[model samples]
Target: MPVYRPSEGCIHIDALSCLRNTGITIYNSAEPRRDSLEVSVRTSRPSCQLIERIESILYSVFQVCWLEPEQTAGKVKPFFYTQGQAVLNRSFFPCADTPSVKITYSATIKVPHGLVAVMSASQWHEPSADGEFRFTMDKPIPSYLIALAIGDLESAEIGPRCDILIMPPSFPFGGMENPCLTFVTPCLLAGDHSLVDVLIHEISHSWFGNLVTNADWGEFWLNEGFTMYAQRRITTMIFGHAYMCLEAATGRALLRQHIDTTGEEHPLNKLRVKIEPGVDPDDTYNETPYEKGFCFVSYLAHLVGDQKRFDDFLKAYVEKFKFQSVVAEDMLNFYLGYFPELKQQDVANKPGLEFEHWLNVPGWPRFLPDLSPGDELMKPANDLANLWSSPEVDLEKVKQIDISLWKTYQTVYFLDRLLEKSPLPSGNMVLLEKTYPKVSKTKNSELRLRWTQIIGKQKYTLPIYRALWASSETARKLALSTFQDTKKQLHINVQNYVSKILM
Candidate 1:
C-alpha cells in the first residue's frame, strides 16, 4: 500500500549510527508488486522517516507509487527501487551517497537463481547461491547511493584491479560502474572492439567520480570533467600514450567549438534547474553539461601543464571535498589557492590565452564576419585605414569573394589569431582542425566533428568510428552533440555509431 505524498515537510535524518548493532535484512524477491526490500532494526524514529523520504522523492520526480514500509519482527522493510534511476537521483534522500557514508550495512537478498546480486563496495564475505545472498558494506553511504540489482549477468575477471560484467538481453547500451558492481547492458555483449574503450571510461568513474563526488550539481564538472580526464589516463595506461595524446588533442578541438556555439545563455555554472510539470528525473541529461564539463577540466589540465600538479590538484580536491557539496567558485578558489600565478594575471590582458573567455562568456565563440547595416564593404577603391596596411593588397581578389566566403574565412582567421596569441601550443590541434588549415596546419575539431557527421550518416566506417571513439573524448562528445540537430538524420546514424562503440 502507498503511504506518503511528494511535497512534504522537513524530515531530519540523524545518522543511522546504530545500524550495525541492529538486525537488517534486505529481500530481493520475485513478488512483482514489491520485489525488493530493506529491513532494519526498530528505532525511536517512525518507519515513516524512510517511507516519507522515498515516497516524496519518487512522487515529486517520477510520479510513481512506491510500496509502503511494513513492520515485521520489530524491523522495517522498504520496497523495490530501480538501481539505474537511483544513481541519477542520488540527492533525493539526505542519506550520503558516498561509499564512505560512515555507516556499516548488512543485507540478505533473494533473486531468481543464476542471476547475480550486486551493490556498492566489495561483496563482504562469500556470496550465497539459490538467488539468496548476504552482503555487508563496512563503508558508509547515503541512502540514495545504496544500490541493489538482480538479473542474468556474466562477468569476466579482467585481472585483479578490473572485472567486466555482461548483462542479460534487456538492459540498455554500455553499463554503469558501481565499483565491484558495474551495471552492464545487454547491448555491450555484441562483441564490438570499440566498446572496450567505453568500458574503460565507465570503470574509471567508479573511483574518480562515484567514489568522490561534487558537492552539488552546479559543481558537477568535478565529477564528470575529472572522470573524463581520468578516462584518458586509463586509456593511455591500457592502450598506449600515443593514442591518448591523439584522443586528447581531438577533445580540445571539439571543446573549443562547443564553447563557441552554445552561447552565453547556458553557463557552465548555471544554478537554475528547469523541471517540467511532469518529467522523468533522468530526462535532464544533456550534452552541454557532461561533454563541455569534461572539456573545461581538460582545459584546466592544459593550463597546469605539469602532470604532478594536475594529479595533486585532483587528489587534493577530492580529499578536501569528500563528504560534502561544492560549487564552481569552490573549484576556482581551490585551484587558485594551489596556483597563485593564475590569480595574478588579468584575463583580458592575456587575450585568447586565458580561461576567462571560455569560462566567463555565456556561449561558444563565433567567427562569422559582421554584416550589419551601414558596415563598409571592402571595395576596389577602399582606402587602407592604417599606413602599415599592405599597399600591395589585392582589392580585386577581395571584391571577387562573396560575403559568405568572407565570413567563413573570417572564422578561420579568428581561430588562428587565438592560437598565435595563446600560451600553450599543444592543446589547440582540435581547435585548428575545426577551422580549416590556414597556413598548411591541419583540420581542427570542428571540421572533424562535422566530418564525422557527414561520413557517419552516408556510410559507416569502423576506422572513423574507432577514430571518433579513440581520437579525443572531447571530439567524440562534440560529434555526439551534433546529433541534436533534429532536422538531420545524422543523429540516428551517430546513435548507431554510439551503439557500435558502446555496445
Candidate 2:
C-alpha cells in the first residue's frame, strides 16, 4: 500500500489517480473473517485517465480484501457489520467520497443464515432465508455514514418520535435510529433511562450528520460536535434539565481528557489527523471532535441564553442543508447569520481553538501550561496549561484551600482545573481523602457528586464507597437522580467505587 498524500492542485484528479493505483488494504480488525473487504465500484468518472487514478487511491487504502461472512466457531470473525458506506467503498463504487458530493446509496448484502444486517437509513426489506438482504438509504450520506452489522441479534421495536430498535445482545455503541429499524446495544436492557437518551442522540443525527454533512474531515466538529449537542438536547427533552446537566458533566470530563492529553494551548477548533512524512488527510480519530466540539457548542448555547432561539438556529441549519454538504465556515457563517451578536465576539478570545491548533498545524502544537501565575482568574488556567508541560508540578496549594470553600461555591470547575494539572501532589491526595467525608454532611448535591467523581477515580477509596453505600437509600437515589438530571455527569469512577461497596 502506498502512502496517501493529497497533492496541491486538482484534488479529484489526484484522488482518482491514487484510487486506481492503490486498490484496497485490509488487516485483521480484531475479527479475522470480517477483516478483508474490497469493492471495485463503478462511478461517474469522466475518463479512463480518471478511472486509473481512482483505482490507485483505493488500492493504497484497501490493499487486502476478504469476502468471508460468518463468525466461525473458535475464531473471532468481524463480529458486526456497519458496512453501509463501507460497502460502497469495497463492493459497489467509491461514492459520496466527500460530503461535497452527496449520493443516494442502495446496497445488496449476501450473508449466511441467522445473521442480521442493518444500515444508517431505514430497512428496505425483510430478512429472507436465501441469505440476502437489500437496504436502500434514501437519505444521501457520506461514505462514512453507512453502517452494516451482522450478529446473533434480536431486535425490540417501539415507537416514540421514531421506531426504537434494540439488539440487546451486542454492546455496540449506538444503534440505527431509522424510521423502521433502530439498532441498539445490549446495555439498554439495563432498563435505565439512558437507553432512550442514546436513541434520541442517534436519531437527531439523521438531521445533523446524515443530512447536512461535513465536506472535509478537517471540519468533523461540524458533524460530531453538532450531533453531540443535539443528543444532549434530546436527552433534556425526554428526561428534563437534569439530564442536560448530566450530559454536560459527562462531556466536560471527556473534554478534560482531550485537553489534558493535548494541553490548554490547543483550541478545540484545531483538531486534525496526524500524518506521516507523506500521508493524505491522515485518518486518525480523536475525542476532540466528540468532546471539545460538544464543550464549545455548549459554551455557545450558554452565550445564546434562550433555548427557543438556539433551537431555531439548529432548525434553520437543518432546513438550509437538508440534503447537502456543509463546511465549518458555513456553520460559523450560519451562527453569525442568526445571532449577529456572535459576529462581535473577539475571535482571539473565543474558546474554540482545539481544531485550530491541531488540525491546521503541521505538528503537535506546544501546549505548555504557564502555571507561573499573574492574576487569580488566570492562575488556574496557567496551572492547567503547565501540568502537561512539566508533569511533576506540586498541587498542594490548590488542594489545601478549604474543601468547604470549594464545596460552598460548588467549585467543580476549580477542582477540574486542578485535576487537569495531572499527576497532582501527594499532599493534595491526602487532603482530598481527609475532606471526602465532609461532603456527606453538606446539602450541596453538586459538591458531593463532584467529590464522588474525583475520589472515585483515585485509589478507588473503599471508605468513601462504603460511606455512600451505608447512607440512606433515599440519599443514593437522590444523588443518582440529580446526577442524571443536569449537565453534572456523575463520575463513572463512582460506579466502580460503588460496585466495590456492594461486593
Candidate 3:
C-alpha cells in the first residue's frame, strides 16, 4: 500500500481540498513543520458481510484473494494474487490515493514455507529457508504501482532478465505492469500465443507509466494514453504499420463503445477528468484515457510531421521527465518548446483544434489519425463482417476465406466488427456457429469475450452473462465496472436482464 517511505512525507493538496470542500473542518490551513501535518480521516463502518469477510478472507483492497490450488508448472498448490490497477492500492493503507505522490520502498514479505512472494520492485530476491522474501525499488513509484503476489508459483524465462507470470483466469486486469514482475490474465494464453501484445503493453509501461507517471488521476491519459502510443510504436516495429493500425482500429471501436455507454458528456469521459470531493479515483477509470488519449498523442506526432524527428522528440521527452510525475501542461509546454517552429505557428491554439479543447472537452476525438493504413489488415475483417451482415448470405464465398489462416488479432478484429453490426439475423447467427466451430468453443478469452457480447446483444442468454462473472470479489468488482461502462450500449431488455444478474 502507501506507507511512508522516509523520514519525511508530503501531504498532497487534493486530499486537503477534498476534506475542506466536503464539509470537514480543517484546523490548520498554513504549512506545518516537517514533522507535523496532522490529518484525520472519516472511516466508514464495514457492513456485516464485509466485516465477516475481513476477518476470514484475504480480500484486502490490495485485492489479495483467498488462495486456491492450481496445476501450474506441473504441480498443484495454493496461489493468490494482488491486482492494484488504477488506485486500488489506496484502500489497503492510508495515502493521498492519487497518482501524483511517489514513494521509494523496500519490502520484506513473509509467506508459508512452500509459497513464493513477489512485489513491484527493481530487484527481487528469493525467500530465505525461513520464508522471508526481500525486495527493493530504488526508483520512486506511485502507490498504485505497489503490488504483491504470493503462491506456489513457477516461472519460465521469456527474455533476458525477464520471466512471464501467468495469472489465473480470475485476475482482475488484462495485465499489471508491476516493475520486476508483470501480472497477466491467463486468458491471454490463447493456444496460438497471439495475445503476446498484452505483454508488450505492460512492458511499454516500464517507460511511459512506471517511469513518467501522471500527476493526478485527472491526467491519467498521460499514463495510459502515452503507453498506448508507445505500445503501437513497438508493435509497428514488430508487426508492420498495417497491423499496428489494425490494433488502433480495435482501440477506436472501444472508444466508441465507451462514449456510447457513458454518453459524450459523462464526467469521466473528459480527457482531464474532474475527481469530485472524496471521490474514488478508481471510479474515473475508462477508455477516455487509453484510447482517446492515444488520439491526442497521435495528433501530436502528426504535428511534428517527421517520424524520425518525432521519435527523437519522444526519446528526449522521456529522458527529460523520467522518474517524475507530471501534468498535461508539463508535457505540452515541453513539446512546444522542443519544436519552436510549431510554437511559432501557434499550433497549440489552432482554432477548434486547440490543445485546451483536447484536454478539457469530452466526446469523440477531433483529430483522427490516418487509420487508412489499417485498411490493408482491416479490409478482410470488414468484408467478412459486411458479408455476414447482408440479408442474403453466400456460404461458399465466405468459405473461400479461411478463418484459421488469420492471426489472433484478425479474428478478434473480425469478431469485434460483427459486434458493431450486432443483432445479426438468427439464421446467420446459427450459421456462424456451424461454419466457424472454433468461434463457438474456442478457449481464447479475447475471442470468447467478444463472442459472448455478440450473443448477449442477440439472445440475452443467462449463460453468456454468467461467463463474464469471475468468482473472486475483486474480479466481480472489475466485471461490474466493465458492465457499467458498456451497459448503455445494450438493448433496454438486455440491460435490465444483466442488471438483475449483477445485483
10 residues in a row with least lDDT, candidate 2: 26-35
* Ordering by lDDT: 3, 2, 1
Q: Which stretches of candidate 2 lie over 4 Å from their true place?
A: 1-80, 83-93, 127-131, 160-183, 265-284, 340-503
Q: Write the per-residue lDDT of candidate 1 for residues 400-421, one digit (tens) a residue.
A: 5433343222233333333323
- The model with the greatest TM-score is 3
Residue lDDT tens for model 3, 1-503: 11232454533233333333454332332122111123442324211111111111121332144444432333366565655556555444444545677888888888988888888788888679999999999988887788877877766666785556777544445788888788877778877867878888998888888889888778889988989998999999999898888888888988998899789888788899876556656666778999999999999999999998988988898999988999999999999999999999999999988999999998999998898988867888889999998878998779888888887788889998898898797688888988998888988877887887787652123445564553457656766887778653343445566788788
TM-score of each: 0.51, 0.53, 0.79
lDDT of each: 0.45, 0.51, 0.75
Ten contiguous residues with the weakest lDDT in model 3? 48-57
Task: Report the Cα lDDT for residue 219, model 3.
Answer: 85
Kindly give the stretch of ten consecutive residues in candidate 1 with the minimal lDDT sum: 26-35
Q: Write the per-residue lDDT of candidate 2 for residues 317-373, one digit (tens) a residue.
A: 889878888876677677777788766764424553432443454322323212122
